[model samples]
Target: MLALTLSLALGTPAQAQDADVHEPSPAERARPDDSVAGSEKLLLTAGVSELEGAAGGGLTPWAVIGGYGTRDQIGASAFYTRVNVPDYHLDGAGALIGFLDRIEFSVAQQRFDTEAVGAALGLGRGFTFRQNIIGLKVKLAGDAVLEQDSWLPQLSVGAQFKKNDRGAVLEAIGAKDDHGIDFYASATKLYLAQSILANVTLRFTRANQIGILGFGGDRNDNYTAQLEGSLAWLLSRNLAIGAEYRMKPDNLGIAGEDDWFDAFIAWAPGKHVSLTLAYADLGNIVIKDRQRGLYASVQIGF
Candidate 1:
């Protein structure tokens, strides 16, 4: 009986050894992990840094164009804009730099043309007014993207410190002789994975731009709430069609200027380029119809 049991154990060992020799190794059986091992580092590095600045209307709050800096570094961008109205026109140019993916600094200058309206106000030919704006933004919490989950939204908070050039022309129109720093705070959120991409933003700002030359009565430093939103439908691999709505304040004491809004269609041909075309109804700016004939902007980034 002992010899029989020993023979069985010896036979089982030899058979097991033969099977092991034909089996695959653990490493050979494992599957590749795409997120951790196969991802392209440069592709992941791209973010807001690749987007151009806002387009069309000035009253509408566009998304923060370039937050492409890394988690602990900085990134920068520059842009130019033009707004042409039936009775007036404006040209603006600006630059922005972001730091540590948490803070941003920006400066912008705008030239406002008063056209024939300037003559009525006792000013010479079309008066050119300039505005210098500085701003800072802090990201509160939330990641713009997370491959593992689909339930969360990206969120951020920001403020702008604007200084109107308040040139001699602006002063002549009753604006404050001294420069003013208008303050504003905003909260923005983006909802991902929806068929119609959407972003909702809310802001409260204090300023007198709504009131020509900041001359309107009841236009003290008071915070006014505003809401802006956008929705886009992907038309193809590189094209998207969208619309935006902005609700503004009626702080201007003058009779013509008051509450207003803008409607627009934007196009993004690729990661590095975008453009927008729109029509704006600026309400009334001083007894004159202030509807902008057309508005356009081109944005390029890297």
Candidate 2:
């Protein structure tokens, strides 16, 4: 997410000076104020929940904190996402709560429907794989917005614990574990003058199919490093266009697991409502090739 919120904050010092020179207007006093001091009001650049329940793009997490909360208050957000690809469909829902812009807690539930492949494997058509995720994030470094002129970027560390319900199925398919954790470190930078935002994340994981097909197989049993990145352009206060790329490890030799990419557009109609639409390419999944799809998500926050 970009730090567009800084633009609003740049006026605070001036506003304070004006207050010393003249009496406040009735309208200014009558208007509703929902944010805390030291924190800007909701910025579209704060971003929405990611697939794994982190604040970021559709496929990867960014360093920005989530929700509308500031440094002195609590904020929360909920989201639902859907992706339809050839021979498969994925649905996810989650919620996140952030505290004082320093810590975040999240939970997510995902269901993957193996439309036709389920039948081919003799597991009835439309068989579904389910997973539950619990995540936590901690802010670790420089602010992406406040220190934009510097070479440093905002940094954070996070972890996601995943548990897949299809243990037997995964074991039968060569998976050695059904539950595991993924750890990641993310950095985000925003150049307000150029209206550009960029983020990079490094993750360590042993999961295949992002844990839907379980973790660590006989073919590969150790966690490995992977990279994910995003670049976005803030076209306006309410609109942003971006692209994301996430690399995956080919752990299970049963089939090739490839990288993922997406082009997306996000719109924030208000501080409490957001929507995102994207075109995604999930390379390959099991027997399916070129798993392209349409991705959509809706989010509400306070």
Off by over 4 Å in 2: 1-40
lDDT of 1 by residue, 1-302 (tens): 56545656677656555644657799899975433212121211222211112221234433332434555445555666667888888776676665655566766677788888778877766966666666565666655434226444445555555555555655544444334443333333333345344556675654455323553234443566767665555454444455556555555454334455545555655545556555666666665865656666554443
Residue 117 in candidate 1, Cα distance off native in Å: 1.5
Question: Number of the top candidate by TM-score?
Answer: 2
TM accuracy, model 1: 0.69
> In model 1, which regions exceed 4 Å deviation?
1-59, 62-67, 70-73, 147-152, 167-178, 182-189, 210-212, 219-221
lDDT for residue 4 in candidate 1, whole number 0-100 = 49
- Clash counts per candidate, in order, are 3, 0
The TM-scores of all predictions, comma-separated, are 0.69, 0.87
Q: Model 2 — TM-score against the truth? A: 0.87
Superposed on all Cα atoms, model 2 deviates from the true structure by an RMSD in Å of 9.8
